[model samples]
Target chain A: MSTSRSSASSKSGARQSKVTVNSQWKAYLQHHRVTAKDSLIRLLKSPGSSIMTWLVLGIALSLPMTLFVSLENVKQLSRVWDQSSQISVYLKKGVVPRLAQGLSDEIQALPQVTSAYYISPELALKEFSAATGLSDVVEGLESNPLPGVISVVPSLASQDAKAMEKLQDQLMHFVQVESVQLDLLWVKRLYQFMELGQRMVWALALLLGLAVLLIIGNTIRLSIENRRDEILVVKLVGGTDAFVRRPFLYTGIWFGLGGGLIAWFLLSLGLYWLSGPVEQLIGLYGSEFVLSGLGVKDSLLLICDGVVLGWLGAWLAVSRHLARINP
Target chain B: MAHVRFDNVSKSYPGGHHALSGVNFEINQGEIAFLTGHSGAGKSTLLKLIMLMEKATQGQVLVDGVNLSRLGNSQIPYHRRRVGVVFQNHQLLFDRSVFENVALPLRISGYSSRDLERRVRAALDKVGLLKKEKQSPIELSGGEQQRIGIARAVVNKPSLILADEPTGNLDPTLSAEIMRLFEQFNDVGVSVLIASHDLPLIDRLDHRVIGLKDGRLLNERPAGGL
Candidate 1:
């Protein structure tokens, strides 16, 4: 009976301590909420300054993010083009249609060639005449001068750019072919340019990110000076540096977050604004490709980046200035 | 009990302006003491040293047995939790209500909401400004603002309270009322040390008084007995 009574009392004490801890946490959160509310209210009160700061940050942040998204879009386009890279070989005149077909079948049997197509000289001449708007000129000719071309398309499943080039060169040695043309130069250069552009975008983004930090730091310094008296009061009232810095940190976060949202909006706006013109241009070229905006994953990353930058800027400002303003 | 001890403490600014020179004094527990001095006599510096706002260039400052000079950065907040301070300018947060100002210390010390509300109300009631709890400090008179400062200082039930010219901006009557409030807190076992140069006001309070001249303690007297 005595043991049971002691155990019961101990359990009650434990329960009491747990309740106390829970209550303490609730109170802590309540205080933080009050502080956060006051901070937001203060920011709202000075809407002009807040807006100005946020705009500066947003513009700064948006430049890199927009560039990054554009670069990503470019990357996607390049990826599609890179995968579509294939060599098209056209044969000379007087190659028999049946011989061209046999050559195509042989090329298709090769491991390097994914597929090959045999176009008879008659069909080739007809297609050329239609494409160039020179059907009357071809009609007056005595014979179809166009070649019985065997087009070779290589597979990208293997990693062999040099091997593919060599294979294209070796196809020129065929007895039935007079000349071979491989149109891979422009595609290779285009891929290289896209990669270079991505690197440049990253470098520029990093440099501008540092500039944003400095801007935020200086702004926070001015804010600290403006609110020197308030800070002194807080310090005198036994507020820790962390407690004193909470609001400024929130301000910085808000700046970053707001700036990020603005940047996202601006990027989307730019993409939306450009889409119609780009689609019309593509239609003129008889292409069905549509320009795409930032994808879901990328948009999320941009928002996270904005918030982090704002947080980092605020942290930098507070650490540098709070040390100088003692109670 | 809140007592402050300065042992061979000295403070010199970076530009070689010596604010305090080997200052040594002991304020006993529950004693209401006046740190009286002329302008730039290091009265402010002394209070700052005790509050651990400024580190001593030499020697140590101990408050309630904690050596502030040796305290770590993280531990500074814990040290401050034991002391309540009021500034010369009242330095009340103008953005907050009087009740919220009083609740600042309690909030920092992590007091529960129910306890914070109760204690803040009690502090405002003690300062005779309970009705003005919802009023902003900026909306109040100078004396009322100083009282709010006082309420903030004492709300946490700290063992020691330091006021640096808390009434410098107030009239004589208001100054006396502020001193009375400090005395009332002192009577209840909270040590009070106020830095002021108002001779007449200092003469009226029956408490210990320490005088500083040129960063050195010149004399000390027992309130009206001086």
Candidate 2:
């Protein structure tokens, strides 16, 4: 009778096990959902401290990000300046306006030149006076001292130092050209400076990323200590390491999400605050350049980085402390 | 086969304090036994070995015919699931409701929500705390809290139950009630091994007793032989 009872139950158990295979996946997802929601609620419950942690993480995340966006704007500014770096060919005193115009047309036809424009002596004098506020002093001269000038913009392919120098040497061979000047030294220096700045930004980002890890790790460690009893009880009641680790991991992820959003907010706010002043300053430079903040892709990246760092920090903290709790 | 077997098991701490030595015993399937000893007599250590909370310093521990020493780290949770444990302090999470507390093991085992709810209610109903399922364990009385712990232990329907000083903080009547609860589970073919120093209670219950003294096996008393 016992054998028959056991066999019948075993048959039913086999059927139940088959159904459990599908339900097991559902249960796993449900647990994750529950843990994630519970962790988020825990964070919401302690809004004061949660915000404090997020703020710390935000500040850490924003420091390098602020530098990065500023560097991006500086790069944009350099590109504008780079396009303006042209060969200024000053003609001899005897050269007439029509001859200067012809020379400009000839230079424009060169394969290396993108465009060339002749600046009459009068326009150059006016620009010089307007820039220096010395119009009256320039009007006192009997003859216009400024020569007819031809400004030559090299093609995109010839923007490098060697190519610009070569174009300068080529323009110097013109008979009407008195001197062909290309002040590319400062542009080259600026390029080097920007490169160095980029390296510095990367280094700063590395350091700050480490700071973020340490901050999150320390926070998680303290939380683990606070929930030590819960952990002990869970372990005592057949909770797997992964099961015990889930809620804390979710906490870390929530922290990361909040911190990322905050960092993005801080960055946008900083750019917005600086934008008006920056536009006024660029207006003084006589260029209509707009200051750009962290764009959507970069904002998403920042958040993802925050999440990854938070997870890593929590994992590190939990692993270290979990090994010590035997119960 | 025995549900729990200790073959000359011995355990020592790092400082050379032996918690158990040459302890050999068995609690057969569906048999209820009491582990009786004074404080520091390795009763807890013996339970720990069965739960894989601590490894024996020497010899073998076989539970439900599986050699525990051979089980890998990842398999420990699966092993633990087959054995339920009730702690002396009745380790309930005060942060949650009694229902959630009892649902913990089932949750850890990844039970479906419907099954979890049903089984949790069943366990709580068995413990006679079904009405207080929504209340926090912190608000419950000592006896109720202990019963909640028992509910959590039995919620997963484990083959064996081990209680460490389960009735230590209870009055005689409450303690007897708890022991009778264990008896009810044993009647349903679940093996039970409870560690306690309450000799009078153990004497009255009249179950088999495995006695330990200074980390060594002292005596084994059959039911009604005291």
Best by TM-score: 2
Least accurate stretch of 10 residues (summed lDDT) in model 1 chain B? B183-192
Task: Please report, as a residue range, the 10-residue window in candidate 2 chain A with the lowest summed lDDT.
Answer: A1-10
Error of 1 at B184 (Å): 1.3
lDDT of each model, Cα atoms only? 0.79, 0.88
Residue range A98-194, candidate 1, lDDT tens digits: 7888888988998877888888878888899899999899999997777677777776643244666688777887888777766667766776787
Per-prediction DockQ: 0.21, 0.33
Alpha-carbon shift of residue A72 in model 2 (angstroms): 0.9
Worst 10 residues of 1 chain A by lDDT: A10-19
Tens-digit lDDT track for model 2 on B1-226?
6668999999999999999999998877767889988999999999999999999889999986888999988888888887888989998899999999999998888889888899899999998999999999999999999999999999888878899999999999999999999988877667789999999999998888999999999999986575
lDDT score of model 2?
0.88
Regions more than 4 Å wrong, model 1: A1-24, A65-85, A88-113, A117-150, A156-181, B14-18, B222-226
